[model samples]
Target: MSNLQAKIKTDSWINATWSEYIQITENSDYQKAKFYYNKGKFRIEMSPLGNDHASDHNIITYAINLYAVVKGINLNGKDNCTYRKTGYQDAQPDLSYYIEDTVDAVPYGTSIISLDEFSPPTLVVEIANSSLADDKGEKKNLYEDLQVKEYWIIDVNKLEIIAFAIENEGSHRIRESQVLPKLEIALLEEAIRKTRQTNHSKVGLWLLEQFQK
Candidate 1:
């Protein structure tokens, strides 16, 4: 209906192979749902979906807000930042955080930052339901390759959180506890549960207390 939406709609009509799509639109944002070449001939590539009901976006936002508030940590909530140069791929992590000290590393007031410009977040969280494979597979590889310090996969269906920490270059090892020792994993879990029950300010307060403690 709007110009931006119209442009996205138009781009969706162009039929291009994954390699061709990435090669042609390497520098620009071509928003559409299509498949791309990875290890095989093709892999389904698109923006993270936000369906009308039970969208991952809402769940991710809620979790991030809770985490930030409970931990009293400064974070930037960026969505749909294109992290790759070659591929019809763009990832909108449910929520991403750049900690207090590293805030100035990235330019301010920008929603989209190039993957090469700044170091990866202390933590990157992906709320998974249907796109679990992509989050755990291709995107997991992407973030690991980018050298993100930590990554979290939150499964809404199962209400479980799995975290991965990078050990060596391009290697991710699963973590069983909060890397930030001051913050309790149980508190985070409780906040997540509260978010699912009701979007409340208490989650934020709980996070702040953890930071202060």
Candidate 2:
């Protein structure tokens, strides 16, 4: 990290000019940090992820993938893909997916996808471990503004999945997923619990049964 980047605050909102935010994102010093910009405020999440966060992230990814495959839903997922709307907004969601009709919307050889040129992800996820508050607050608004159809936050400590269905720039808590259709939130919560005592493969087997139902 350069002295300049070292001076920038991490994991908090900073009043930054649009140009500053863009420059910081392009800097190699903050490559690992998740970046967000909205209403002239910029945030860089530089916290080191722990085991619990990573575990939830992987399990959720696996669950989503398996559900899509079994149910034959057209899905293209991106882990930490950045999307920006020039001077207005930007976000690098922890997990992003283009579902059903938009599965192949983003073409090949694209880097740092521009929201102006392509449709935004239909679903966005944030594995909220230490950043649960921000995930539900500022990040929620961000996803809403991005117009994603659905947003999910996986709470690591509670082993809960909080899902929201976004519409008309507002979000409402939902127990079931609208985008994936018939994918129950409760089943995902159960799968996370089972992983504590069972191997991932066994947990995966259980998940398969759930998805098939």
Which parts of model 1 are misplaced by more than 4 Å?
A: 1-19, 23-72, 85-90, 109-112, 170-181, 195-213
Per-residue accuracy of model 1 over 3-49 as CA lDDT, tens digit each: 32333332123344555445544434443543233322233345444
Whole-model lDDT, candidate 1? 0.55
lDDT for each of the candidates? Answer: 0.55, 0.90
TM-score of 2: 0.95
Q: What's the lDDT for candidate 2?
A: 0.90
State candidate 1's TM-score. Answer: 0.63
* Candidate 2 ranges with C-alpha deviation above 4 Å: 1-7
Residue 69 of model 1: what lDDT?
65
Residue-by-residue lDDT tens digits, candidate 2, 92-198: 88899999999999998999889899999999999998889999999899889889999999988899999999999999999999999999999999988887788
